[model samples]
Target: MAYENLNFKKAHMTFDEGYFYMFDDGWDTLLQRLADGGTAFSYPLSDTIDSAVTSLEYDGINFWTLQDPGAGTITIRRWQVENSICWLKNTLNFSTFDSDTFTVEHYHTSLAATASGGTTDIQSASYGTVITSGTVLTLGPNSSSQYEDVTVSSISGTNMVLVSGTQNAYDSGDEINFYNNLWIFNNDGSGSLHKINARTGANITTYSDSEYDNITACTFARVSNVTSSTVDALIYSKATNLKYLNVNTMSLYDTMTMDNLKVNNTTIIVIYDIAIAGNTIYRLQKEAKYYGGDYSWTYYNYVLSTVRRFIDTVSISAYPTILPNNAVNVSEITTIVNDQYGDGVVNKPVSFTDTDSVGFITINPAYTDLFFGTGEAISYYKAGIVVATVTITATATQYD
Candidate 1:
């Protein structure tokens, strides 16, 4: 690799060796150049527009102005709305002169709404107050004792008709009406419109009536699906309209009614691979074995005997043995006591002897031998044979 090292002695270097000299004076110019490139454009020092640019000009297509603060200083301000001018004068404290000329530019307008009768045909009613579009109207000073009344007669496309009246209540219903739907307020504080189904008599599913009283300020409840085999049941709440109550069993189910099934709370068991759809769940009791005896195992079955049966059926014949052939013998040793005052009394000491046969037996490896050998003799001998003996002596008395 070829490299060149150039050194400068002056603080500022002029273009010399066919390359421009970039001097770093502890400013961001070097940082910016290193970030992007040496030929990158530098950012502007100030972004505020000059305040002296004036002399408005209309170029037939657009209007603009340039302000000159004499001596070549210049500023440019755009012509905005009158509110913007007021804001600039009052809020921003911009200096204004009477010589500044305001120019108006020509634009295009359309009469589509007037020609199509889209905006003119729609009428308005009172919502208790008189108001107009694009025009402001103040409230109060009405003779009918009504605060404000403005009514919207119809709404079409992007246009609407509204009217104001002094009377609080109108002789006719609201000018606007929803054609297909009606609102109902439930007594339980919930309100909704019955869309898919209609209510009739005690049977809420029937749609026979054309003019049923509107269910306003009434409790709204859910009724589940009902079937001929079983009556629908409502699980909670007294509102029968919204819930499914089993007429036969008096049991309750949710909106989606189900066949009334008897639920035995005590007999309800949990079994594997079983699920509770409504009020029913089931379970199975299991059995197991230890030492080839039946043992009650709760919930699930753990079949040790089945495992043994499986082992027997297999070709593998090696069975697990828990104990050795030799039986473990446990003996208790006792010391005999003689009674003196209990009728049976003797002068000489009596001796008691006990002998226990201890042994082990094992089957021959050939599986032919039944009995092996006799056990060794175990004996216990007392000190002497005695009928009665009593000895008592007082030692010391201690006070507590």
Candidate 2:
């Protein structure tokens, strides 16, 4: 399928080992098998709905679609998969702002419980205090074996009061999942970020920052050595650069400049999207020159850098191989930090030191910049009749 004509709007990788590509040339969603070039199925939006499909998400079990019928109205539908067939399970309606893109993130919580359709209460062996009021949950295996999102309005003992009745009858020991937030960012460079409760469909908060302007795409990843704990950092591409934001702190964490970023000798024009699965990061970038007529798409996959660091340095002085005796000479040292894969690691700090304790050694810009992962160190020699030897070393910390 050609991705031209803005057909490839979103891609979702399910637990089934492949990806479901959503195309919006009037919207046609299809799942492609990665092991072989074959189609699992294709669902056309025009066949069932007249509205435009804005986003499609697979939450490890079933599928969900977000549609916009215009005028600040949005519709969300859940599709149940059973016996290799797809069934329309539920349709949820809401009134709010309009957006072209919607990102659904599953909160890190799971519980098993039993409940019936048309009921407002669900019972588990014991919920304890793990779930509270305003918390969003998803009940699995409805009457049609589908999943549905519900909000906990109140909690008492081991029971939960859902904001609304359950759509599908869930059995004992049925898996219940939780949802965190639904993100909708302005694609028009407004820097506005709107968050909605993914389970309750309620607007959580809205905020803005100039750093978030012109966002092209974003993904959640808990990259080691870059971010702390189990919290996933929101990696968003603004123009050609990628910025990392801590979701917990809602603050900037790090930035990756992609102006000269390349994969296999091809320079990336822009980053279209980013996705992370386990320790691997998948980035979709434009390989074609911007507005230059020739165009192509490229994919870059790499293991997250918890790799050991290797430093290579070269020192150059005014003299060819030896410094003049009884004269002052300056040497410029360049240090390049690379991981085990030989790829230059950017935005890393390097420390330079020399054995000279007589105060004639100095290093400038002791840290690497966004453009280059290199540092400079300058050393001076005092006028002396005796010959001496000094050893210089460059050090970069390795992250586990």
Candidate 3:
């Protein structure tokens, strides 16, 4: 009902949790503002600090700083590391821990996913091997190798003691293997990415671990809570690109060029920070403009990039378990996809199938996709043509 607009020189910006932190070159202060603009506070970081903070990224707590031109350095600082959300980053791939003795029931390859959703701590399959200490387990999707490794310190029964450190957990149906290999990538002509064993510190420079050429700062922008074969990230070069890093394949899944938006009116720049919280992809942008001899700047916070919601459950409209062979197109079988909010999803791919081959199942893409379709059409065969208990099923393929 009411609004207020605050304008200040934006030298750097970051967003995490639900707050927007802004900094200016002149004032050695950090402006911590609530995302909704309900409240804000400013604290002194020293004029040197404010100007040096060319760009910043916040993971709800603490700051990952990308300094401006004069001081080309990447630094992370916060109140405290132990209680901070730094553990919830893509750079540090550690998993949920319940106890010291956890068993690696199975190793799911990235390619062939054996586990489905909701089945955690238990793999669909199990490894029968009785191992010793120092054996590293690479866990994730088998085909992708976009996995995390856990080194064993000792073993008892079927359980093993993981080398105490920060490690991410793997889930069921994920590909698990006996290796601690990681394809570390840097701009090395020796290699674009190196296939190195994290445990042994052995680097294979010629393995060609990454497809991202001439790019740096390969950090992750986590969207979904699940860790599998992919990591979402904003990779910058001549242009800002959205890249999916498949840890399984040890390469980039795909690259999408993000269309730039002009912010400062004087000039526009690439997005500086990105995060996927729930179904929304959020971005923070920055630009600099030289006024007189002094530089003026602009920063846009919490820009909605895109909304990608997944199907939590599929809702089926009223349908008959037993359809008469002679029944006409009187009844329609509809498919519905719902997110966690119990609302029908849009543009999500759904397929319809009926076991009774004698009848036809017509899918209403226009209606069903829009979440308000009349449903589906079911035309059963005329009497005495063929009789079978028709099992009509509707399933979701993807979320748009």
Candidate 4:
């Protein structure tokens, strides 16, 4: 095997379809072919356009970036790529720029709504906090000719009241784009992380915790391919902190800590940036040591199980289903959980039950194994148990 080492400046990254893109030195855009690691291209943007790009995101159609143009305000621009050339489509000048606001995420909710013509109300679980009165929303961007913009007159419990009425009918699962509702964050040393809904200019939620005091970088991640509650955000603090924040709940779902390799017993690890592709997370890290003031930067990637692979098929193991009525005889009943792709799903909860209380299972809620996704429970039909044939059922719980 052969290898090559190259140096690249720290930059922002995004992925669309099958191609990966990044901005090196905040100015040069590079596209790499993931299949063969060949066919690479680089295009450097002029300083007149924007001095530095703080954040970059691709939403399967256009590339969006937040830039610092040596001015007091921040500029958000959208670009379209044609024949490997990027053409600027639109630009938005935004004030109140903060240094901590260095990441931008293009958000597409897995939610859809249905409404009839002249309907004055829309119901959704997402209108809890951010979708309030006076919030204008653009509905049904699913096609070129099927959309209407409406303003919220008031909020009644969980329903949103429009200022006027719908102009056309909308079906369920239709795109409800609230003006490209992008997800961005602001960490102002308040020990609170504010998730801003760029569409309505309202905050989605504020997660108050000391763990997020030093947050420096974040990116959106996909949890599953399901239509509802599928997106999460990965946040990184300057300290040794990494966590997954559920977008809907505004709470921490999981935390991760990576160990640093010790060379001189004095090493500091810093996670620079993070990006997600499917279930894989790519992280750029810097390790600094006091020995001769040595430091090195490296890129690391890890694969995680995010999609909740349901039980496509369940089968009993080689254990005997028929057991003797003797008290000393024990029947080890095992159930296996397999996904539609015929792969084992680990750590899923499996419960064992019998009909009419004929037998008792030792482990009621056993978890699937890491090896074969199989859970075992001891089923005993002893002397007091009936001799009639009983059915044993195993149920697996889906997890995300």
Candidate 5:
């Protein structure tokens, strides 16, 4: 027969001789029989022997054993021999270790509860201070907790400077350049243009104002240069004629008369309020022969078709001069000339002759000067049309 339920601690301490039985616990049969007094000799039970023999003992009303101590303040160990046995024992006393020097273990489950895609709850059961609403926790320099409040300092620059909680100072020379969205000098008298940053008043760059001919009344209409280092500024003057300024040398480069600027047999008028739109220039002019009175306003759109058309033609021949050697191949020269004029001139043949070892080419070119016809009329108009043409001869210089 099998014993269904047995408590080893409450089993009989005395037993019959010449009989053997197995204790449910792991004690040796001989030790069990000796404890029961089944042997002839009497065996005295020591504290160490009894402690080792009994797996569970009464500590007050609870069944527990005095566990062996570990290195730390609180340690636990669990072991079982057979069946449905489970045991948990604390190996150390909380009152034995020093309170000030004892180490504590912390376990955290969720850290990013406020982050995006976070689902776990942020619990503050282990922390001393609970984090309520609007309280931000920050890490300190040495990994501790800290809180901070930020503030901005002062700002300073060339044209203007600002101090915290103080008045801002503005220099007399500071002015805004509306076209370029930058600050320039109002009247520096130094004949130099200084570009300044608007926000910080810092000096960004400086350019020579001599390109505008030391004339502050002139306005820049456009800038054109095949080569960026050498640019031509198209400037308009209120009192004088239109001038092209050389940016590199800062000098008056070229000039064109108002009469020379013509389109579709109409004398172009200078209008002030018009602005340059892309490759085209639009202007508003007063028509002298308008059906209405002279006070009538008329707007005219002058599309720079010739300017855009001749740009490729001019760039081809002009690009070579800006190059290193001042020389370009025959194909490039042909492309340059063809760009200026259409393909009609490409098929036309030319005759060339060499005289005095100088290369010259001649073509049938003729024109009539209607302004001065013969010696009879100092100022004359040709066939009721004010037009002029002349015969021209040209030569080309070859480079070695």
Candidate 6:
């Protein structure tokens, strides 16, 4: 079974045996766990977490969460796993290739037209179909002429395609070459290999792979013999149907083609946040059971997938990590006007606690009741005159 704290600023969560430790970083609460007197490793949320932390979960080593950077509704992030693979993806195309062969001679600066298909203002557009083959082209357009404007009847290698079109004539001297945007680019470098961070929960290097321009949620899956590095560089994701990336080389593979990403049951995977622990991937799969009239969606968090049967295994128990908070530290020192002299305090206000409600100050990554990160929490504070700096006493105690 898995558990979570519903508190908005649930900044930290770690594991100690069977218990889960949690704390409110916004309010600086003490570390509280699932069980008492247990020692668990602390996974501190980073200072970069956004304000609108919608949800959170842990996968033993690191935390996975959905954040609203106020930019997009969903910004998926993983914490503590600092090692990220940054690569210059060579996925954009700038050239082309043919199956087994290509021919500059195959293209003719000329074509033969004939008045066979039609013969009026509608014009019988028939090109030389017994000498040229511009129909087997791929991507943008067919080279042989299987288009609405130019349709090929029969063509191959040196055989011309008997195409009929809206041309006034069809005999010879017409432009016949494959002009496709795909021919202007290179093959999708999706097969290219990449690197990975060796440490679990290590941040992935920020490299732009615009090819993955989508609402993609990703996580690492440490698999054996998957790469050449001591660091397992496989990234399992729902960023498009890609199964995993041997990030050690930035190379991607199909889950079906490679048989890597397999669904154990018929649970359709609608990926949310993904986290990994103990070589298992904990996915958040949402399910909506249809009873009679309406369907209410239920979330299944911590859906485990082991390394051995990572593709086939269904649910299993794992832990959650603390998601890093991406909040900006607004620690600038400033003085406010009251009656001059020495307006309250200055010099980078580290701790802004409003003892008196005189005037209010504001900050952001707007704090909400639904946030989950420890990043910059929005707070409102007020001040007044003659506020002398009062010393306070405090003591820390070990929890049992």
TM-score rank order = 2, 4, 3, 6, 5, 1
- Residue 117, model 5: Cα distance from true site in angstroms: 22
- lDDT of all predictions: 0.22, 0.54, 0.42, 0.54, 0.24, 0.31
lDDT-wise, the better of 1 and 4 is: 4
**Which residue pairs come into collision in candidate 5?**
367-389, 367-390, 368-389
lDDT of 4 by residue, 1-400 (tens): 1121122344455655655565554455544434233436765443235355656666545666766554456666666565666767666665544433334433343223677889997765453455667766667644445666688888766577889998987776665534334544444455555555554445566666665554555666555532235554644544544556666566766554433334554454545455567755454444433334445545322212233335656676525556666644556766767664355667777776666354566677777786644433223323225676666678888765
Using TM-score as the measure, the top candidate is 2
TM accuracy, model 5: 0.22
TM-score of each: 0.13, 0.56, 0.39, 0.50, 0.22, 0.29
* Clash counts for all predictions: 57, 0, 29, 0, 3, 63
Q: How far out, in Å, is residue 177 in model 6? A: 58
Question: Per-residue CA lDDT of candidate 3, range 98-157, in tens?
Answer: 110000111223212233323222222433242447765555533444445556676654
Model 4 C-alpha lDDT versus the unseen true structure? 0.54
For model 1, the run of ten residues with the poorest summed lDDT: 305-314
Which residue pairs collide, candidate 4? none
Ordering by lDDT: 4, 2, 3, 6, 5, 1
Candidate 3 Cα lDDT to native: 0.42
What candidate 1 gets wrong by more than 4 Å, as runs, is 1-147, 157-159, 164-400
Give the candidate number with the greatest lDDT.
4
- For model 6 the TM-score comes to 0.29
lDDT of 5 by residue, 223-312 (tens): 342123333253333222344444335466554222223343354434322223233322222322222222222322111222122211
Minimal lDDT window, size 10, model 6: 97-106
> What's model 6's lDDT at 347?
17
Q: Which window of 10 residues has the lowest lDDT sum in candidate 5? A: 98-107
RMSD after Cα superposition, model 2: 9.0
Off by over 4 Å in 2: 1-16, 23-29, 35-55, 62-80, 83-100, 109-131, 134-176, 221-223, 258-268, 285-400
